[model samples]
Target: MNYKVDPGLYALGHPDADSPVFISANFKMSFDHLRTSLNDGRSGWILVLDTDGINVWCAAGKGTFGTEELAKRIESSGLAGVVKHRTVIVPQLGAPGVSAREVQKRSGFKVVYGPVRAADLPDFLDAGMKAAPGMRIKTFETGERMSLVPVEIVHAVKNLVWVLPFVILLSGFSGRGAFLSHALQFGSVSVIGLLTAIAAGCVITPMLLPWLPGRAFSLKGVWPGIVCAALFLFVRDVLWGLHPAGALETFAWVLVIPAVSAYLAMNFTGCSTFTSLSGVKKEMKWAVPAQIAAVALGAVLWVTSIFV
Candidate 1:
């Protein structure tokens, strides 16, 4: 649980009292990146704060990397005694939780907001500790979005453990054909469809957010889900060696697959760079209700289709 580093001052290289000090959260990855960025003979001091292993931006938002913690760390680390200068550079993302004036008042250390990206730290520091406009911007590029895919997949798998089994058991209750064989047939189809939907929402849509055709994360996710549904339907005959899905099966997938996908995609807002707190709330106000309706309708149709 403690995915954090020791909270204190760490030296990038041997330095005198004149060396510059930078502030960061104690997340190992964040600490590592900060240290790695400073590896090119740019000697400095890094003052780490306990953020429970979360990145600076997230920790700041959560208040773990805020004013009080920063002030406390400054006092506890004996930073006053280590340096001649009193200025400490902090990531701009932490501005939400840290008041520059308050940190200075308590710790006698002036706080300068650094660039938004840690990779820009060298340039930021070299430019007399001034951050360029570009350095302050947060862009949700493809690579950034793709970075969250592993976590998304892990969440999906946890749910699928129970969901897939439930689908298999329910499919056995279908009125047509031998129960076990029918379950196997329906379950296989369900598994592929569900997994496709999850990937569409959680992986594909996020990676292609800008081009996916909607402002809402839920809507963006649906585009991929629809495509996956169609592909699954088209290949059903060849893949399953069974007859094509009937009207109900097709309708069910069309509704539920994208609905579930949308739900999961919307949940990604917490990790997304593009979304705002208000925007997500407004989107969910209308979207959650609609998604629930779609999933419910799909379930009803699927059940009725078994006997019909």
Candidate 2:
């Protein structure tokens, strides 16, 4: 049980002749959650189709969760020999990629669409039914909304390290006191600015997705960045002791913070429920150039502030 199974066939809790067979993506998180959701109680066969570490929705979109992979995995796993039933229950989100008829033709097994979430598998099996509307529909509730933050934070940290040395170097060139003190202050401001942008793009905007007033992810991320920049400028200049330069520096940051965050957030389109490939391509056409301009402007202003 502790060993890593190949991303094909897994037997959970010793399934018998009558046990149900479930199909899921090969992504570690998907497999782990599915097994955990069973809680050592269910007797079933889990057919993990190779999705190349991608979750169901994305894999489905990219055709990794297609009929061919499903059929191949089923045949190679020798699943037909283990189970009496010729049925495999698949996640509803994967329906777009898989042709059930083709899978049945190729693999000799009928495919049944299951509930949207792995947690609902037990009840779904107990009921012995097809997916209901609620089971098929994707929902981004509070709990689901919170889970995406860690990945975003990790990516941010990795990228932040690359930019940190430059920030320190710039801060050191800014003033005459202890280099460490100035570096620390600059680092703090930069981190605050980065985290604020992340919160705006990844957390707040997504949570308020419907009300964010944008069709594209860039626009969605931009609104939050604008609000966060306003608040940040207010707190840093009005309340805190820091003094930013003229309107240029202020305007530059207002553009820069959100632009970077928006670019990062736009990358999430591949993982989101609403984003399409065509849409993301279109948004990137405009978003990428805008981001570059904003960052360049901010860098220029920051450098100018030291001299003037």
Candidate 3:
């Protein structure tokens, strides 16, 4: 969805020249949330910077919410005329890309980082823009993580499309009956197993992140992925009254499912509030190579399962 507003200054509830100015991305949801949260009883001037329809945290990480964008927006929005104060409140999460000192030097307006959540804006502004200790602390509460599930699912499903054709071709070779007779059935089961593995990583792992055993999402995701793979095999055995493929097929599942799940789980680091940019980079260095190795080996195993 293209949720974006024109990049400029917006007045919330008849904001006057003396009203506080808040900096935010042009994503409509981010803009709406900030305005709605602050609309309780106070008036404010909102300076929306173009982040190409992305949320503040992501845009900030992507550099769209950097010093240049904020400085340019401040100038283009005519914020000087709209607000009397020289300081603008920026979201705390946006600090990674934006240098407060640089913004000040360029825009001649001081940047003050506000609370992490927009809901805390009322208290923050009411207290003369002094953020409480709790406001500065970043949190990824259950609801916030849950809200991200849909987008993750969509991204994962897009990548899974490539697996479909491979799945159909591979499973057909492993089937016992005439190729055409069992290809569809075997392909269907493989797809189910693949999707289950993905869900175990994308949905189950993220939902139970706090309780999951490991700090590394890849490790945490592997456990559920293994369980999902096992269950798929068990279900096929029980329903079809036949051994699903052979040792090679089981070996392939052992590698592929967890590998896929680990990869999907790793993607969550980008969405997390706790993981540092440098930490994510370091983790990816080792984790990506391992995941690639496992996936490549598993694909080879699956292809060879029919002949060997």
1 against 3, candidate with superior TM-score: 1
lDDT string for model 2 (51-169, tens) is 87788877898999889999999899998888898999888889989999999999999999888898887777778765556777787766775677778767767787787777777
lDDT of 3 at 69: 97
**Best of the candidates, lDDT:** 1
Ranking by lDDT: 1, 3, 2
Runs off by more than 4 Å, candidate 3 = none
> Runs in model 2 with CA error above 4 Å?
1-4, 38-42, 175-191, 238-240
Residue 167 CA error for candidate 1 (Å)?
1.1
> Which lDDT tens digits does candidate 1 get at residues 71-102?
99999999999999999999888898899999
Candidate 3, lDDT over the whole model? 0.85
lDDT of 3 by residue, 1-308 (tens): 66889988888888888888888898998998898898787887888989998889889989999899999988887888777779999999899889999999999999999999999998988798899999999888888888888999999999899879877876677646678645677777778878987888898888888888888878878888888888877887777665655888788888888888888989998777788778778878888999999989988887787656
lDDT of 1 at 268: 84
lDDT (CA) for every model shown? 0.87, 0.78, 0.85
Clashes of each: 0, 0, 0
Give every collision pair in model 2. none
Could you give me the TM-score of model 3 versus the true structure?
0.90
Residue 124, candidate 1: alpha-carbon lDDT: 86
